[model samples]
Structures are given as C-alpha cells and as structure tokens.
Target: MSGALAVIGLGPGSPQTLTPEAAAALDRADALYGYGPYLDRVPAKSGQTRHASDNREEGSRAAAALRHAAQGAKVAMVSGGDPGVFAMAAAVCEQIDRGDAAWRSLDVSVVPGVTAMLAVAARVGAPLGHDFCAISLSDNLKPWGVVERRLDAAAGAGFVIALYNPISRARPWQLGKAFERLRQHLPASTPVVFGRAVGRPDEKIGIYSLDAVDPSAADMATLIIIGSPLTRVIERPGRSPLVYTPRFVEGGH
Candidate 1:
C-alpha cells in the first residue's frame, strides 16, 4: 500500500471479469485514471480521486499518475481491457524509460485483465483456441507499410488475427487496407468476427465470412477477429452459435 503506481485492468465491464487482485489494487489506490466512458463502470467512493480523460491523451494522463505516485500517493491507472494490449500500461513504461525521474522512483506493475479478444472469443466459444496473433490497424504509432507487412505475415502463418484499433473516426480506411493485405494470404471464406464495444452496454458481436464483412461497419471501439481458413462458425439448434478452428483430426480417412 506504499506510494506506487499500478496499471489495473478492470476487465471488459462486468464486475465478474475483474480479478480479485485488480479489485484489491483498486481498493488500495488513493487515485485512479482511465478513459472517460470506463469511469462510469466503476462506483464512486469517498477519498478516491478519479481522473477521467477522452482516451486520446492517455500518455499524458499516465505520466501525471506516475507523478502522483512519486509524491506518496497510491496511484492506480485503470484500463477497460488488458492494459498492455494497446492500452496505458505501455505508455507509462515508455514515459518512465524516457527519463521521467518521478516514475522511475516508484514501483510500477501491470495487472492482466480480460481483453476484448478474449471476451469475444469466449462469447463465440473458442475462435482463438489455436495459434493466434494480434495487431493494431491504426498507424498512429507505426506506419501503414509496417502494419501491412505484419498482417500479411500473420495471414500466411494461418494465425487467427485479433485486430485492435481497427477503425476510428480519423483513420476510417486503415482497417480496409489491412484486410486487403491479409486477403492476399487468406481465403475469402474464412470466418471473421466483429466485436463492437465488447463487454459493455450496446456491445455488438457478429460472426461472418471475411469477404462478407464491411470495414465501414467498424468503429474505433470495435475489435475484429479474423480467423484462418480452417476456422468455422456454427449455428446451433437451441443455443448461441460457436466459432472454432479445428486443430487436428484424430484419424485421417
């Protein structure tokens, strides 16, 4: 409970998704910072300073939280999904490495939480039970050329792709280009899933063929899961459909 900073994962939104460790860390924090919308999911309590942001300037907020911790405050940075999966934990670490003396003075830790990909995969049964990979379609930090290369490689590797930051208002066409690159290595009939605002209210989960998905339908909050050619989506008679990519067959006929 000493003055330290921790990047806490609150999970997709459900209290059930929150790990006991993350809950305990949050309970011990004197202050918390997170995206504005995620703040509503956390109940307010006296003496707990909550800093909300528009989610764009996560770096600056994380830097400030580090400062608070250095000043003897138990600062916990909260993320909607897992912190290291395109979230604030890495940002804080980056700032610390870049000579933020205050941040270096404090003990920092990243607590894992349920990410969108995991939540989506769980909702769909197990689309990513086999070998998989993740990428961010946004070119904010990395160039499109680099992103394209990685996408193509992942596709050819037959890895289930969990695409983060797939689309946003400013970069609406990024996902389209990424899918195009991937298409070169994957079949059109491959199973694909779009999980919008996953684990939160207004969450929309859809499974379809890769060729049938429209990138325009995706938004910044959406997480896309494009499966390998071996993947399939099955509709059940009385339950929610399931997604799976067969790993192996016991017998070859």
Candidate 2:
C-alpha cells in the first residue's frame, strides 16, 4: 500500500489567499516537509510531523519526503506560491526521476495556489495582459549567462518580464545589471513594478519608470514586473495608479 505525496502551494504569504484544495491537501498529509519559513505558514496538525530545512535544500528535502511517502506515510511537500512555478514541484519531480522505483510508484499530486507574479499583478492591475515570460535571476542552479541571454531575448521580443529570486545579500548586483540590460532594449519611461511581501502586513508595491527604478529597493521577497512599451499607467483622483498592458497590439493579429 503505497502512500501519497502532495506538493502543496501555500499561496504568496496570506492565509486568506490559500486555496481550499491546498488546505484540504495539507489536512490529509501525515507529514510535511519544506523550507523553514514556508513550513511555518501551515498551521500545525495534532499528529502530523513537520520537517523543516534551509531554503537551499530543495533536492534533499524532496528526496526525504519521497522516501517517507514510499514507506506508506502520506507526505506533503510545501512551497510558497504555486508549487509548479519555480518551486517544489520541479524539485520533487527531479528527485523522482533519479530516485528509487518505490519513490516513483508513490501517488503524487500538485495542488496549485496564487503565485507571487499573479498576486503582484492583481494588486497593480494587469501588466501580464499581453505576452509575458518569467525568468529567475538566481544563478544558483543555472549559469548567469543563461539568465542574461533570456533577459535579452525576452526584452528584445517585447515580452513583459517577471523576475523571480531577483536579489539577495550575496547577489546584490544582478538586479541592477538586469535593469541595465533592459534599458538597452526598452524605453526609459517603461513601467517597472516592485512588489515586496505582497499580501502580507509589510506589503509594499512601488511603481517606477525603468530609468528611475532602483534595484536596491528589491529583495528576495520582491517580484519585479518590467512592462513592455505598450503598457499604460492610469491615474485616479484619490486612488493608487493602475498599470496594465493593452490586450491588442498595434498592426498585427
């Protein structure tokens, strides 16, 4: 009797944003495994066990969760935002691909939740209304050159870019470098949004032009959206400005 493994997304950072399906999956889990901060998001259950690890231990954490599930104990691997979006789902799948046959045999499911970019986009209108692509600025897993190339290609092709894992203490300069790269392809007046800890108490969403935007304003918790030339900003009398990209582009279908 193989047990199940559920990769659950806890949404951005708000309990109110957690999906019903994710809540039920968490309820059914006999054990949970995830990064310390993300594991802290899920309320504790009476008999359920939690195994918390460092944020960088995705591979080992996935393996441990799979091993637990293979022993007939229902396990949930938790992630912040949507599990499939540069999160635990890919880690779990990678482990399964190279892991034991029993690990592969375990029943697995991924429960979706609101990812950071979507949450940020909703808070400030839809910059994602047009064609968009997400790229992680972190070079931990891949080469920095790959990130640079993707940024160039995405910007050159006029795709609105959503940057994840933008900056940290160790890699403080990359976001600035990214801004520089974008400036080569985009207008100085292009809209850029820095959404930090969105949906949480300390949430901060700042709208800036590409030339005036400061990379130091963002951290690992921030999700930055770089709008295309067609993106517009609408002002209201007493409300925050709305930022959106028109669905229809000029001259092409």
Candidate 3:
C-alpha cells in the first residue's frame, strides 16, 4: 500500500498562524520531518515519530520523508513558514522531479501556511500594498553576483523589497551590501523595516530610513523590508509608526 507525503508549513513559529489544513495534515501524519528547531514546534502526538535534521539538509530531510511514505507511513515534512517559499516544498518537488517513479505513485500534497514575509509585513503596516518582490540575501546556494544583480533589478523596478535569510554568523556582510545596492537607486530617506522573529516571544520590529538603517540589526531570523519610493510612514502620538506603501502611485491614475 502506497502511503502519502504532506509538505506542511507551521507559519512563523506561532500555533495561531498555522493553517487548518496544515494542522489537519499534521494530525494525519504518522511521521514528521524537518529542521530540529522547526520540528520542535510541531505538537507531539501518540504514534507519531518525529525526525529532526539540520536546516541546511533540506534535500536529505525531504528524501527521508519520501522514504517514510514509500514504506506506507503518512509523512509530514514541516517548515517554519510556507514551505513553497524557500522551504521543504521545493526540495520535495525537486526529489519528485528527479526521476523517482515511485514518488510519482505516492499521494503528495502541499499544505500552505503564512510565510514570514507576509507575517512581518502585517506586524508593521501594509508595506507590500503595491508592487513588491522577495529575495533571499544568502549566497550559499547561489553566487553573490547573482544576488547583487537581482537586487539591482528590483531596485530599478521600484519594487518594495522583502529580504529573507538576510544575515547569518558565517555571512554577515551580505545584508549591508544589499543595502548599498538599494542606495544607488532609492533615496536615502527610503523606509526600511526590520522584523525579527515576527510571531515569537522575542519578536522585535523597527522602522528606519535607508540613511539611518542598520543592517547589523538583522540576523538569520529577521525579515527585512526595504520600502519603495512610494512607501509612507504615519507616526502616532504614543504608538508605533504605521508603515505602508500606497495602493496607487502618486497623482490621479
């Protein structure tokens, strides 16, 4: 009997952000696999075996889930945010596409959840209300040249940019370089948001201008949003400033 594989997202470490479908998939899973910290967020259930691996071993972890499904175990591959966005779903799909005929026979599905970028955007105001683009600043998977070129294009296109995997212990300088790239196209006063651990207890969010922005505030867990030329920030008397990109461009359209 062929079993099933469900690629699920837990959504930014908050149980409240988990989608009903993702929760249901987890409830049905006989086995779960993901990065150690992300897997730790999953609620333990009777008869469910949890497999944890390093965050960098996404492909191997996905393959483990596939193996479990092949052995007639309902497997759930969990990611912190939406799996399709820089997570296990792409790894699982890559596995399926890589000449695995047995994987074709398995019942495979993706249960979507709130992505970190969107969660971070909401935590502030609607900075993505207009045209926007998301990119990962990590050069481990790709070259720094490619990341720079993409940043240049996004900046030239006037897109509000959401940056993921901004900084890590091994590669801390990339975020600063990305900011420099944006400085060429955007004004020094461009609004930038640093949302750290959006839904977690240690969550911290700050808004700054491109001139005053500090890339050092970012870590791997941070989601950085660089506003477009049209983005606006409305300050309140005794509350956080509201940051938003208008739905329409300047002038009557």
Q: Largest lDDT belongs to which candidate?
A: 2
Error of 3 at 197 (Å): 0.7
- Each candidate's number of clashing pairs is 0, 0, 0
Model 1 compared with the native: what TM-score? 0.93
| The 10-residue segment with the lowest total lDDT in model 1 | 244-253
Clashes of 1: 0
For candidate 2, the TM-score is 0.99
Off by over 4 Å in 3: none
What is the per-residue lDDT of model 3 for residues 78-143, given as tens digits with 9 covering 90 to 100? 888999998889999898888468988999999998998899999888999999999998887899
Candidate 3: 10-residue stretch with minimal lDDT: 95-104
Give the alpha carbon lDDT tens digit for every residue of 108-220 in model 1: 98999999899988888888877899998878888888998898888988789999988888888888888777778888888889888766678898887777778988887
lDDT-best of 2 and 3: 2
Displacement of the residue 177 alpha carbon in candidate 2, Å:
0.3
Question: In candidate 2, where is summed lDDT lowest over 10 consecutive residues?
Answer: 97-106
Name the runs in model 2 displaced over 4 angstroms: none
**lDDT scores for all predictions?**
0.85, 0.96, 0.90
Off by over 4 Å in 1: 249-253
How far out, in Å, is residue 78 in model 2? 0.5
